[model samples]
Target: MGGQPPAEPASEEYTVDQLAAKVGMTVRNVRAYAGRGLIPPPRLVGRTGYYGPDHVARLTLVRELLGKGYTLSAVERMMSELPDGALALGVFETLVSPWTPAEPEVITEQQLADRAGIPHDPATIAKLIELGIAERVDDGRLRIPNPDLLRTGLEVIKLGVPLDAIFEMLPKLFEQADQVAKIYVELFRNTVWRQFADAGLPAEGWPEIQRTLENIIPLAGQALVAAFRESMGREIETAAYEELGLPPDEFSSTG
Candidate 1:
């Protein structure tokens, strides 16, 4: 039978199954992951472990980091490095809570099977679960832990890079990501805030700045991807394809 309503809003509490449906995993794997110490264990409410919105948010971050190139080991290690002792953990709790973005349309197991042309098996579901994409809850429903990450994961999978390969490369990607974040923080303090100090822009320019940050991230990501692709274009055009004995169409460029 369905249990009592959550102490807070249903969207805010995000029962284990609801979280699982958002990220694309099964309930069993979510519990197993908690057992493995990958994430902070959820609080048990009655017969089910109640995962709040925070777990969903962090799980999405974990998925994003993994997609960018951080291994589970590296991710766990980085998390460990976040401020020693309880104070740091408290700070981390606040920092991670607000910045997470959200997305629409809950991705379901059936939808993934249709898109990837794969079966919704336990092993595959478990892999998705640990990765923070899916959760299978006690109530027999599959949920997404982070709705924001669902769209990103779907695109990353289509790039033809296997999840294992992505997992192996995640650590390096995360290192760079941290560095970039630090640089931006410094820039915010130095140039954006200081140089424009007298501009009194938080209110006046914030709308614009928000628009700019929104526009810039995707634009910058695409620009870098293009630059990297072009840097290897000559090699591909010459004989790399022939040497590898692959089809020319694989490297076909509109450029």
Candidate 2:
């Protein structure tokens, strides 16, 4: 099946042992990732650490990447480049947090063909797998880890954006996003999370830490939206002015 994969079931809180089993990882490996900061520290509830949906998603993604032949050290380095909250949940999820639906759509291979305007394109499907957008499951159905990206790419293609251009641009976009994320994460880490960590991670401080972590997602999103809008507006204004043959000084400062 090459269609939209079914949404994963709602995530549940899991103990360390349960989480390890759920993700098909040995307990030792799970703990190893945690220690390496490849995953977030679990929610501390007394002596037991409880994991959440974010943890499950992160672990699954890590396993998938590893299965695709990424070395553990390479995966760890790539993951380490993500912003703090990003690693804890997922880089994709963090970037698309505002718009992501609670559940992903499920469609048949025929439906996917309809969307692509091709009944069966093995090369195209293979490219999708290479891009990490979709994967073929054990049952033979395709699973799209990031459906938003797939839909967006399809829309852009329909709009005449060449596939090659899209492919060429994705890596550049990811690099820029990662760079920007580091700036914000450093700001928060230095001023907030790092302090909490250095203080022995006292139980009483956990709520504040969690609250700050939760707030960072939306706050960073708002900043990104603002910056993009401002940049776009400037570009549009310049294009419009050039169209009218206006000099720079002919325009009054809008700001």
Candidate 3:
């Protein structure tokens, strides 16, 4: 008889310290997460505990959720209800990851001023930061989070719109955009996400949920742009008629 049939080779394993290092978490945090039941208890071999890939995936998921602005307690509740934490994490990421990735441009204060056609003053820099158009880095340089937005602002300025006016309009624009985004998000939440959650968040249903979300991503943007174009056309036509002192009926018939 062979000696206990040659001991099976161990799968990938990590001690508590090794697990923390592997997942880029502190040992204390790893223990804390375990205590919170966010991750399953480690396997005890003699007096020592070992963590495997599942723990690594769960910890990685928790970190990602926190980085995405989820509160710890909220993450806890979601983790607690998940049938397969790793798969759930993948679906959650697909749902929340940005549809468009923005590549930021870094420039000095003077360069930013030159591009924006504004003075290189503290007030202007502050305004840029306040409007979220730019951020100041540790090296005293500015970062344009969305260069396309900056280009649009410059184009608007070229149309004889003042920089101050653009700044003033941004807050209102943000509010309107937020409202529109909420409407779309609520539509999905009340329908797809709600149905999935109500069905006990079955593992088999995740793929369908993910597919619906991916489809909606581009469709939502297209629909929003189409609606905005129609509305803007109507508004511009009305304004032009008023400016030229034409009657509504005449404009409607000839516009």
Instruction: Return the top candidate by lDDT.
Output: 3
* Residue range 19-69, candidate 1, lDDT tens digits: 778766676756665665655776766566677655665565556556658
TM-scores of all candidate predictions against the true structure: 0.39, 0.54, 0.82
How far residue 141's Cα lies from its native spot in candidate 1, in Å, is 3.2
- By the lDDT metric, which is better: model 1 or model 3? 3
Judging by TM-score, tell me the better candidate of 1 and 3.
3
By TM-score, the better pick of 1 and 2 is: 2
Q: List runs of model 3 lying over 4 Å from the truth.
A: 1-18, 43-53, 99-106, 145-148, 248-255
Error of 1 at 119 (Å): 2.3
The per-residue C-alpha lDDT of model 1 at residue 154 equals: 59
Model 2 alpha-carbon miss at residue 1, Å: 67
lDDT of 1 at 31: 63
Report backbone clashes per prediction: 24, 0, 0
Can you write out model 3's per-residue Cα lDDT over 89-170, one digit (the tens) per residue? Answer: 6667777675534678999989877876766788878988988988989998989988888888878877888878888999
Global CA lDDT computed for model 1: 0.60
Q: Which 10-residue window in model 3 sums to the lowest lDDT?
A: 1-10
